[model samples]
Target: MSPAGAQPIRAKSRHHRLQEHVLETTTSASLLSTSYLATSPIAQQILARDLAECSDDDEDEVKFDSEDDGDDNDDSEEDFSTTLHGGAAAHLISRPSGTIYGTLRPIIASQVQGSPAVNERDLAQSRREERSLLRDNHILPPKHRRPFRESALRQLYRRIFSTKVHESGCDSDVGKALESSPLLQHDYLSEDASGPPSPSPSETDVLWDCATVASSNILKTTWQREAKTLAQYSGPLILTFLLHYSVQITSIFTVGRIGRKELGAVSLAAMTSNVTCYCVIQGLSTCLDTLAAQAFGSGHKKLVGLQLQRLTYMLWLLLIPIATLWWFAGRILANIIPDQDTAALAGLYLRVLILGTPGVAAFESGKRFVQAQGLFHATTYVLIIGATLNVLANWFFVFKLEFGFLGAACAVVFTQNLLPFLLFLYVRFIDGMECWNGLTRKAFTNWGQMIRLALPGMIMVLAQYFAFEVLTLAASRFGSADLAAQSILVTCTSTTFNIPFPLSIAASTRVANLIGAKLTDAARTSAKVALFAGCLVGLFNMTLLSSLRFQLPYLFTRDDEVAAIVSRVLPICAAMQLCDSAAAISHGLLRGIGRQRIGSYTNLCSYYLVALPISFATGWVLGWKLEGLWFGVTIGLCV
Candidate 1:
């Protein structure tokens, strides 16, 4: 059977391994059965390419010769031996017996070995199944997702303030927006962290949980509870501010009766000292608001007292520079006041005023410290006594003994000193001393942190007040008639402003507490409610001021000319009152969250950059007089 130049026949077949336990079909025709990855898609692709290239080969007829082939209907044995290897490689033995051979592989061989027609539907179905299996096994492809820590602080605030208990939550988103704010965010407060201890069930705000409160009775109960809680803190707080402002009003009232010159001089002096020293002190004191409120809210009772003491120490140290400014107010008075006599008297007044600078720091620190711990009533009690005593002293010294302007200054200084003395006694003897650890060395230790907080606070509060003093100074340049009218208007507006200022304090304190206690949702709700209430109160004040514009001036003096001047400026004052109220509350909110820097920038832009230029342009350039000055104030507030 040998012949010269004979070609050797070649045999080829594909091997496909499969997972034996698979319940469904796969792309590779069977589940791969191997410890390693049994199906290399790359190998399958190469084999497919080879098979396609060889498929066109001819002289490969595969037919079996059966013995019983006489009848056309007789069955013949089928050959399962030949496998097309890329249509190029096929082996057939040239045996003398006329036999053929091929490999019988599982799915691959059965699919294409002898079949002339391929069903694409079955092939596609197999491919889909294989892909699905690969996905289930998670081979090669990795998924991407955002980190949960991004909004950690926001979620944390919500959980802390919410009365509703949650199994798991992300609460940091709300605070995430402010996380980058240096003044508000603490180093320890991680956006994705669990901050201070969450408020206890009893401390949690029930109003916040009223989303599920279906019945009328339940809603009523919740409102009553929240209202009572708010009143307990805000009532005495409001009264305290009212009484304190009454002290200043008493000084003005006593000074006003002496002479118009004295009234204007004292008013200018008060404005000067306030802007240069007192206002800045008050702003710096807010650091206590942030620290003590949270410390108390989180049940860190001792920390509140320590922070209070720290603020006290910090303020006294700051008073040195402030007192120096007050010392030179008389010389600086010429910068604003055109009258030589008034400026000279104002100088004497500033010299006398600087004596009370330390007292101002002490008084403000004590008030904020006590109030932060929820001892609202204590503040009211102390302030009422101080205010009453100041009025009595003012009457005796000014009218009874004729000490005049000096009497007014002395009485105010005494009253300011009285505030801190009373608070110290109360803290030493009263029920609210739970948080006071009694002035420790720790107060002096963490001063750097306190200074950092105080600077922004001072700037925030300073911007508006400094601008107001400048406005008063601008009024002084308008002569005694304008100054006296401005004096009356300023005093009256400030005294009446007590309404919204207390609400602002309540808002800030409540927010700080809720935040520290981890009552995040409650903090947000409280802020919204406080702002709404402040707007309502402000509108009411604006209406009252507008209605009494012409009539209210007689309370201070019988001077028809001054009263007429006040009437002309009343509209501007009325408008200013509305913006002022809102701004005051916003200040409180900012202080609560330790965001004083933002408030500072807001005030700086509103007052100096926006309001001041317009006021000067209108008052001097356009000759609108005192009305222009007041209008500028309103503009600042609106801004």
Candidate 2:
């Protein structure tokens, strides 16, 4: 209880504090080292040795603490030195206590609290190594996948749901090592699990900032990649759509050369056919987009053929009633239309078109069949051969053979039937036959689900097609000149639309792929690029229409009155191109994200509620006519 006793107690207290500090520092440093070292066999051995040394030092301290109280004050420093120099921990902390806390303290401090540059470099290197290993093992991060060409619908479902299986050996030693190591599991292999705990506010801010920078870099690099991808997908689609639509356009061109009345009649007939037959067939065929793709994606490859057969059978059955309507179309047209000659001619065109109805049905269903299997180029090839034959047939039948207006109808019927025949040949011999499982009674059985999906799709197509057709029908009331002009306008606008429409499809596919891969930022960037491309396309179309307004109409009609009316109205249609392209791309983006219902609703409301009514008001009531009709469409697109 005297000064000598107090002095020993003070020295013991100091020694105790030093021991505590060393223990705390060593434990923290070991944990930090373990994080980086766990993947390496050599580092793991060193960690084990260090851990064992720490345990021995703890035992030595316990033994020292339990020693007799009278003999320890002079021996305290020697004991401390002995503890510090005895094992791997002592070697790690080689400096004497008097000079510094020992070498391990400074190294640990430098790692934890020194320059961020060194830490960042090490962290970056660690990440690079991890990524390299993942790549070597064919283990992609959940947010990324190797790009490949696949069906858009398939990509959408597969990517979004993470249903795609990689062919890599996930049972490899690297994978096993990754799975066993807690640190590696936490960092790389656990993303698909419940994920890490939510970061704190400050941590979240830092993460967000880092993500923003990363996203910016990704955008810069991926923009060209996405654009190139879209181009590859869209190019053939554009040609296919144009060539298919040109079947109708050729009819208009050939018949228009006959006279104003014939031009007007063909326009009316085409509109009627689109509304009653083509659009309905197209809409119904949309079921295959989901059905065939799903069946193929689910590995039910035969079901794709079954779906096509089912839809085709349904369409053929539906064609019976449609054929009846077409047979009586002349009489039906005479009752509603004021121009009897135009009506009768249109009716004649429809009657001839009825011959092509079965072909139309076959081709529409067949397209989805091939497309679901990522055979988009198949349709393009068919259309190329078919479209060339169509142009030649129209020229032969209408002019060379001098079958006149009737020859135009004949040409259309031949081309219509020829398209399916060509597509069938492609399927039978070239490709897409893998899906076909021979005609089965199964096609007759599964009509209900197809009908349900078909009806909505049909309605979606009907809504858009019907609106334009209605405008054409309305133009009939103005006179043959206006009707002919309307036909030219419709043909031109529809043709121009093919550019952006195909681009939209490509964009939708890309965006859906990214979204399915769980790359939200990448998807967003792709959408932006698509929209920008749409804008450029819109601008190009606008410029073309505006500049070539006068020249373009003459291609469809020889009638000066029709051409004059078309030239006057073409600029208004041109102005609508920008809005049209933007809307198409926006819808594609929405579809990519599985929000297509929103697009469908918007399209219905915008056309029915905003566009059609305004068109009627301005064109009919306000007497703005064709220009007013298009003005309403422009406004609706903006909405």
Candidate 3:
């Protein structure tokens, strides 16, 4: 077929056959069915250019054929096919009869061959159809819309005042915003004309259904109902269980590191710092929880801002006393421990812990505010951040910093302070809620509410602290070892008993909100749920601690004498959880009803007037050592 001396092409040699096979495999599938993809308007132009490259040599022939046909329709078909293979023509030769060209085959031939154009067209068309369907279904378009800042602000106002507009509206920004909002807009009718009547029955029913759906959406994933709320109790219970075990282990390990005097000092400092902070934060934060929950449940939006402002006032007031005490805690430590060195260390611990007070309190407030809006996951994340910081700081300070008790103290402060600041910042900037402005200027007005909430709770905590101090003194008369063992046992209890803290917290808010909204049945259901859950958690903790009784003392000491004494008292520790759980849950329920005074009185009677004296009498007068003392305290716990 060539000019001169060229033989006709024949079958390939073995090597040639291999070469052909390799080329066929190497050719891309994309090039084979490209014509089919060209049906898309965007792809159609691309196909035309590719087809021109394929028919470059036959362009004149095509031009002549087009002229003879005297029709422009054939020219378009020629352009399309030629454009489709433009990139492939340098290497590909068209098969005379088949759709495929030289050295190439379709990868998905069966899928494309019957109606290759239809196959690709359908795929492209399907995507368009889907987009069209979405639009037709009334989906919001993906266009930038103006921020509804004023609307959000107004809504926030309505949340606080709920459109009541009592007291004839004051000159305050909140009052002004409330009065100007469309929610409060009620057009007056002219004397000559009457206004339209309200909606008919069918319209009312439709509105009711819409409202119900919206309510259901808010409650769907939340622990709001009887079944779901109760089900949620199990997770927090298990998490608390794990945390308690870890805390107990940590206390025992810490006490085991040094002597009894050191152990007692550290334990006292730790308990005082933690419980004080807990009382301060929780007590002040309770108001936010109550306010936020009421605001949310009743659909009063601006109340969130007011609640936060009120909490801020309480926090600032409490901060002064706490900060002052912390600054001078070392001087005061002398009276408690009677050892200059131990007292100094306790004072240092107090000072270190105080550094985190503001942050910790703020964090607690933010958490309660978010949680009252039904954000459980926010609480979960806050705990996770605090716990992670706590563990990391403990490891670094104790092991790497080599600061011992001081390091542990610093670690606690670091976590407590950091989490609050972070949470507060997040709530302000990123939470996207308009009411976040409450953290700004409005926080000054709610001082009265915060003080009222903080005073009782702080006093109660301080009383508990004093009671522990007396017990420490009583235990000290038995010698340093007895004091050390008692300190370790208390740490173990702290860890174990903390398992119900979250449950109590959840119960307090859940039940309180329902009660506030007059959902008596729901409130009762939540109480039962919390009670059953707390009992199960308490039982589980009891079983776990009892099972590990023998090894517990060893974890806290290498001294055989001290370990033996502690091991004997392990049974008493096991029984204490039962009383602790009942009291803790009862406190929670009472707290929900704003009866914290009841909780304060109960703690005073049980620990101060009862447990301390019994411990001293049995350990000293009865000559039974630490075991007898613990047994008496357990009996006091029971009463």
Q: Which candidate is the best by lDDT?
A: 2
lDDT of 1 by residue, 140-220 (tens): 011222256658786776445533313233233322333343333133233333433332221111111211121111111
Better of 2 and 3 by TM-score: 2
Give the top-scoring candidate (TM-score).
Answer: 2
* lDDT winner, 1 or 2: 2
- Ranking the candidates on TM-score from highest down gives 2, 1, 3
TM-score of 1: 0.59
The TM-scores, one per candidate, come to 0.59, 0.66, 0.55
For model 2, the local distance difference test gives: 0.63
Would you give me the overall lDDT of model 1? 0.55
Worst 10 residues of 3 by lDDT: 102-111
Higher TM-score: candidate 1 or 3?
A: 1
Q: After aligning candidate 2 to the native by TM-score, how far in Å is the CA of 381 from where it should be?
A: 0.8
- How many clashes in candidate 1? 36
For candidate 2, the per-residue lDDT at 227 reads: 65
Model 2 agreement with the true structure over 503-544: per-residue lDDT tens digits: 776776566544432345656767888999999999999999
